[model samples]
Target: MNLTSSIRSAFTPQGALRASINLGNPILACRDADGAARGVSVDLATRFAALLGVELELVVVDAAGKSVDVVVSEQADIGFFAIDPLRGEHIAFTAAYVLIEGCYLVRDDSSLRANEEVDAAAHRVVVGKGSAYDLYLTRTLQQARIVRSPTSPTVVDTFIEQGADVAAGVRQQLEADAHRIGGLRLLGERFMVIGQAMGTPKSRGEDAAAFLAQFIEEMKASGFVDEALARHGIEGASVAPAA
Candidate 1:
């Protein structure tokens, strides 16, 4: 069957992406003031569904914790999240689409620099609880005392407001942070490069993995991904076929 047909038969009358997935999301999917799912996640999910000629059923998580319980519990077929190898053991990822660096976020008046110096015991670092950065900090910076916030915005805000020595998130997010939280500056070069990929249920079956891989490849070849990021004012981004 064609891709369209695959989508049609992929679920029952409920139109699930997979058998166990129950659609919902606060940011990605939501019952608007009138109860409707909307946001950047919605747009991406919609586009992917249209690309495959399928109906998208969103699955909402607590928007806290791992924030991917929908996919992890087999309640959803895929999820969009930052790519990390630590997560790779549990889930399959699409190709590296967007690049993010875990950088230090500090107050403009602060004497610290982003990624300028090694993390030491005296420097307190704040990151979202259960975030990829949290895992990185726990594993890499054994000496630094790590503090956890419940969300990305909170960490950025707290860091700017003098809640911690630094905060961590993508550079693109930092651009937004400068406007929303003020008095904050992104510090240092990237600590590590993280890619934005789709989370598919991990499996020995290459079908899902292969689809994600090809989706990323075609997006790069067509320039659609680049155009999308550029339109959003995100710069210095590129996509090239693997050598």
Candidate 2:
């Protein structure tokens, strides 16, 4: 895609493409041994900056909500996030480049054997504050009470600490936590499928949004996203279909 002046200005008014990198989602991004951001999202942001012919300034944060805030407040040129209607009000999202499953976890002794058993008045569910699953469950789970953890990576810890009945988050994350912490098991089925996408502030205008959407489609078609996932050793997530 040609980097038109208007698209350039929309994406980099500050003379650099400030990409918000959320380390909270391990599948998308994480801190390396040296604490530098690295993962599929970081790779995508780097390539997008190269496409725009601008310097890339990563505005790294520890949580998904902070990433969304940086983009919606125009502090960053673009960010990666799960597609949600609430977030869409302030940010114009591109078509999803990856799809991830949202699953629930419980102590091994817990009676909740299936995903359908999670919603009950007696159940207190723990979730990453302002995460995709949090937003999703808040609207869908009619009876269960939600307890918010500081971030997605902390969901399992928070769940155990608070003695909550259920923990919710990305499947890969929950699985790793279950293996690390032990004595925890995931429900038989996923509760939701999160569509992870790139987004810019809505005020950036349609041209910028259109360009991002096109960029995602091209990346998916060219196998950039799939390659990034494989390069990062990401599991349990798939490249989204062309939009």
Candidate 3:
């Protein structure tokens, strides 16, 4: 064991190296001045790569249906998004990093301030078609009428433009332009906080899951997750270190 460890230590660089695959979210991902993608996925992935002694290459793709297709086809190594068990056949997921709460945005002047006030027929809820948010509404709020769009940002815009009464969106975009959401108000509390896990091609290997587990553990110890959140201007998160 010691000999094997010595060999690995000698072969590995003091810094991280490159993996067989690396990925980036084409649609939701934002880039910094250095042109590196920057978001929860970006930050976390970078840290994960660092932990594993590998360099993360942000694989860019066209902005359309499930950018994860690149990862699924083995064009990339990892996919940082909400995990779906149905897709488990093509990709293996790491332990979930955080709870993804699907939120609803409404006009502050509207009557949907609370979850109790959600009305299926009265309010038109804009959502991304075939998205996790859509699935949630379809399963949980069977009564709600949702206008399916292609993305969360567009859904929020639908409500802002008076095309819909409500919009389903992630926490970041909802809070990013908080004031410019066109007088919109966050309706109700979180509808659901689905655990989000990262995915890597099943054929690639098990290192994806191994590295993610260790990455999350390190982030928890170093408070990197909280710092990442604040760096993006996000607030009201329940992410204090767990004792």
Candidate 4:
């Protein structure tokens, strides 16, 4: 894939490729011991910048909504996010490069043993504010109430603090929280499969969008995504099928 000047200019209007990285989702991006950003999404951002022959400037944020805002407002040239229809209005997303399970966590003593039992009048589901699960549940769960934490990493803590009936988020995050907090267990099944993908502002144009889409496909087919996940020690999420 040759980089056209137009595409390069579209992605580097600020003279460098600024990528918005959301630290909310541990499976995609996170801070290392030195507080530097390092994860699967960071690897892809670096590779994409190298391909464009530009410097990489990371616009690191702590929440998914903030990452989306950065890209949609063109403050960053690109971002990593879960594929969702509401976000699509302002952004053009590539086909997903990873598939993550969205699961529910509840106190072990609770009677909610199945995913189907969650959407009842008496249950209160807590999720990360503006996360993929938040958007999905807001649209789908009619009977249960939804509570939001400030960020994905805080979902479980907020759930416990608020005494919410359930906490919803990435399976890995929920599992880790369950282990760390104790007395919590995940439902037997996942509520959703989140498709994680790269996106750019729609103002970047169709050519830029197409180039990014092709780049993601190449990354997946070439096993770059898989290797990055393993390098980051990311588990529970699988590489998305080629689009």
Candidate 5:
């Protein structure tokens, strides 16, 4: 895991690697009982720091927009994010390490029985502001009106409070909310599959990006990524297809 001087210099300019860990995506990150961040993304950042032979300084945030903003502003060296065309303008993504589902939730009696039924003009959908689901639906949903909540974890509450026709978010989070509150059912199938990846500011030279891409691919092939998911008891996410 020895890093060349150039790659190290480009990525870890401040000596220690500052990683922006977003806890918004429960499938990727979460806070444990000790209030410490622990999840797939946290594991990846830890391993990444080991590979780079540096100290890991975690810049934790509760929302994805904050994570992206930190990386783009160089407040942190890198962050875990969903690969989206819009984000690529400022960040370079490594090949995805995991695939997470994005699904819709509706009241038990709602007419939206299928994923495709959600895009009708009359239906309003609520999503987390700047989340992968929010960005994807915004681009692809030509008819449905999108109501953005302040954050991903609050989407369910926002949907219930605002009386939005549909709620969109990580399948696991939606399922948890449904179980806690009752009377909500997930749609038949997921509307999107998000590619969870590590991203560095595009301003960091391509050598750093290439190095990270290779590191992720190797981690997948070597079973390290799978081990992390299992260690964290994560489910409904799988190793992404090879780059």
Candidate 6:
């Protein structure tokens, strides 16, 4: 479907599509060895801009919460985010384009052997402030004490420094940390699977959101998203199903 002029204006009042790229979610967006923003989310946003026939201006932020704030405040026209009810209040989300596993990482010798064993009164879980995992765990974890790290990438370091029992974050991030540092192991089962999607501020209106949603569905149906993931060498992330 062609993008209506009005919908296009709503999405990009500044003539360029300002896309918020969250650097915190490595599987979605991250800096390369050369310090360039390169990841599945960046590639997807570039494709969306091309489809709109507009220039793509990436607004890079280090955390998911900041990414949402930029879009909601109209500092950016759109952003990539993990779908969560808390974020839904401020932004209109497309059907998820990727599914990222969320799991706990603990020291190799820790007694927690499975995902189900994470929530206990004695366990202290460290999560990035305002992250998808933090929001989900806050609402669901009844027994464990949750601590906030400064950012998602710092969760593992924070866990080790604070002596927290578990570090909760994107599984890919934890896996990389496990390989880089010694004595870290992820639980065999995933506690949550974050649905990553493109979003615009709710102020952008339903028609604009709907237009973007259709674009996302088309990309998924045509395997654009899957191809982008492979091209970026993203692993442990799968293309989300059609809406």
The prediction achieving the highest lDDT against the true structure is 4
**Residue 180 of model 1, lDDT score:** 83
lDDT of each: 0.60, 0.94, 0.58, 0.96, 0.92, 0.91
Better of 1 and 4 by TM-score: 4
Give me the displacement of residue 146 in model 6, in angstroms.
0.7
Give the candidates in order of TM-score, highest first: 4, 2, 5, 6, 1, 3
| Window of ten residues with lowest summed lDDT in model 2 | 1-10
Q: What C-alpha lDDT, on a 0 to 100 scale, does residue 84 get in candidate 2?
A: 99
Tens-digit lDDT string for candidate 3 (23-107): 2222235666896556666777676555445566666532222545666776566666565655677877766665656677776
Give the clashing residue pairs of candidate 5, or none.
none
lDDT by residue (tens digit), candidate 5, 156-196: 99999999999999999999999999999999899899999
Candidate 6 lDDT for residue 116: 79
Expressed as tens digits, the lDDT of each residue in 56-158 for candidate 4 is: 9999998898899999989999999999999999999999999999999999999989999999999999999999999999999999999999999999999
Q: What's the lDDT of the predicted structure labeled candidate 3? A: 0.58
Candidates 2 and 3, the one with greater TM-score:
2
For model 6, which pairs clash?
Answer: none
| TM-score, one value per model | 0.76, 0.99, 0.72, 0.99, 0.98, 0.97
C-alpha displacement of 9 in model 3, angstroms?
Answer: 17
